[model samples]
Target: MIIDCIDKYELYQGLGDGVSKALEFLVSHDLEALSIGKHEIDGQCVYALVSEYETKPADSSFFERHELYVDVQYVVRGEESIGYAPLQDQVVVKPYHEEHDYALHSGNASFVNLCGGMFAIFFPGDLHMPGISDVPGSVRKIVVKVKA
Candidate 1:
């Protein structure tokens, strides 16, 4: 998984022309005003989702595998703790479901706190768990999905 600091996004422009454009759009836009839906910009698919307390905790099973479209998890407001574990480290607590494309694993996972402007990227094999609560309160975050 690539954990890019917002400032270093420019360096990755050559990686994928579309990804560069997607990152540019995310960096330039005001996340708070957006709705949860798909937005087409510069011929790229930008799926925007504004999440509040109503959103459920991310299913670890889902993130264990799958080539992700870049997962730009930005916290527009408040703090959130996200869980993570490497694929190689995973011990299957539950077998994968072909229909759902996920499986539950056994182990103590790691977590990271995402605040305003802070984000994380999860590629295939990088299992991530998001939407966790902080001690102070809940968080409002926006996840922009871009094809990787």
Candidate 2:
């Protein structure tokens, strides 16, 4: 997992071609102007999903892992705490669904607060629980899916 400002995206460019492409998209485009829906970049290989929703309590959500994609989640508006845990010794609450590329897990995790303009990268082995907060609040986030 990696968390940093969008401007520092170049530092992580070497992670992979897809990751670099995702970072480039985050930095190069006007995320706030994007509509709330999927935006294509590299077809199925890479794309961004713009979504807005109310934050939920941490306990109400479970950690999720993706086998086929690395998620580059950027907060465009408002702030929220995201939970992260290493994908080890965790039990799956729900099996993986290949079409969605995700599986749910229940485990302890550390939380990071991300405000506008911040982003976090979740690799395949990173279990992440997003949309977490102590109090409910609106958040607009762009999640770039990079094929792993």
Candidate 3:
């Protein structure tokens, strides 16, 4: 789990080639104009999903972890609190589907407030529950998938 402002994106270039490309895409593009849907940055190896929706209560969702990809979740508009937990010893609430690429885990997560220009990177070891907010409102967010 890596939490930092986008201004510090430059400091993570050493994360390796795939992650560097993913960061570069976010830094170079005009993400605000992107429509709500999946945009392929480099086919399936690097792609982003733009979405806007009302935030959900954290208790309603479990922390999810992915094995094949790293998630770069960037908030484009509005503020929300997301959940995070370590994957260690967590029980699986849902089995992983290779096609969909995710598995839910049973555990408590600490909350983090994210607003516009902020992003969170969740690798295989980071269990995260996104789309959580204190009030009822919509948030525009982008989740960029980087092949692991």
Candidate 4:
């Protein structure tokens, strides 16, 4: 997992070639102007999903891990918290949905708060429970899905 400001995104471009492409797309575009939907950059190789919604409680969200993609999540308009835990000893609550590329797991997670301009990158082995906030509020975020 990597958490930092987009201003320093260039430092972690070393995450991979695809991550570099994803960061480039983010810096070159106006995310606030993007409508709520999936925007493709490199066919299925890279894409961003713009979402706006109210935040939920931690217990209400599930810890999910993806096998096919690395997530580059950025908050554009609000603050939210995300739970992260290594999947090493976790038990699956719901088996993986190959079509969706994720599986839900039951385990303890550490929470992190992110406001506008902040981003977090979760790799395949990183279990994440997103959309939780300290207080219920609306958040507009873009999750860039980069093929792993």
Candidate 5:
């Protein structure tokens, strides 16, 4: 897992070609103008999903993990709290779904405030609960999926 502002994206380039490409796409494009849907950057290897919605209460957020992809979640607008926890010792709330590449886990996590221009990278062993806030508020976020 990695948390940093988009201005420092270059520092994470050594992660891998896919991650580098994903971060580059985030910084090179006008993400705010993007439609609320899937945007292909490098076909299936690197693609981003733009979404806008009201934040959910922390207790209602579920920790999710993806196996085949590393998520580069960038906040294009607004701010919210994101929960993070290691994969170990968590009980599976929902079994893994291969087609979706995710599974839900129930565990305690520490929260981080992610405002606009900030991003979080979640790898396979990182369980993350996003779209969380003390008070529900609108947010526009982009989640770039990089093939792992």
Candidate 6:
């Protein structure tokens, strides 16, 4: 997990070639106007965030592991807790769904608190539970989906 301002995204460029491009695209685009659609870049799949709704605890416990995409979740406003667990440590709670491109894993996942100006990257092997509320209020977040 990495938490930093959007302007500091350049420091994370070398983390991976595909991730770098995704970050660059996110930095250059107007997140507020982008539609929630899937777009391909450099043979990689990317999902833009157009808007956000209220997040709750029930929405937080659904951990998913994607086979073809890495989730680059950026927090534009508010704070939320994201549940996570290492891939190797997960016990399959349910079978993977090929159509949805993800699986459900079982375990006591850890939480990463994400506030505005922060972000987290979850690879294919990482199980993540997003949309968790920090307080009783709602949190608004922008999720940038990148091909794994």
Measured with C-alpha atoms, the lDDT of residue 49 in candidate 3 is 94
Best first by TM-score, ranked:
5, 2, 4, 3, 6, 1
- Which stretches in model 6 have alpha-carbon errors above 4 Å? 36-44, 49-51, 58-60, 134-136
Candidate 3 vs. truth: CA RMSD? 1.1
List candidate 2 stretches off by more than 4 Å.
Answer: none
Candidate 4 residue lDDT tens string, 101-135: 99999888899999999999999879999899768
State the RMSD for candidate 5.
0.7
Clash tally, candidates in order? 0, 0, 0, 0, 0, 0
Backbone clashes in model 2, listed as residue pairs = none
Write the residue-wise lDDT of candidate 3 on 19-135 in tens digits: 888888888889889999999988999999999999988878888889999999998888888899987888899998889899989888899999888889999768999999767
| Candidate 1 per-residue C-alpha lDDT over 1-148 given as tens digits, one digit per residue, 9 for 90 to 100 | 5665666778767756666666787789877777765566644455666666633444432334444355667776777777777877667666767553446665556777777667676654567767765344657776666665
Off by over 4 Å in 1: 42-45, 54-65, 89-106, 134-136
For candidate 2, write residues 1-148 as lDDT tens digits.
Answer: 9999987888998999999999899888988899999999999999999999999999899999999999999999999999999989898999999998999999999999999989999999799999999999999999999999
- Segments in model 3 whose C-alpha atoms lie over 4 Å from true places: none
lDDT of 3 at 59: 71
Q: Sorted on lDDT, highest at the top, how do the candidates line up?
A: 2, 5, 4, 3, 6, 1
Candidate 1's C-alpha lDDT? Answer: 0.63
Give the Cα-based TM-score of candidate 3 against the true structure: 0.95
Local distance difference test, each candidate = 0.63, 0.94, 0.88, 0.91, 0.94, 0.73
Q: After superposition, how far is residue 45 of candidate 5 from its true place, in Å?
A: 0.9
TM value for model 2: 0.97
Candidate maximizing TM-score: 5
Backbone clash total for model 1 is 0
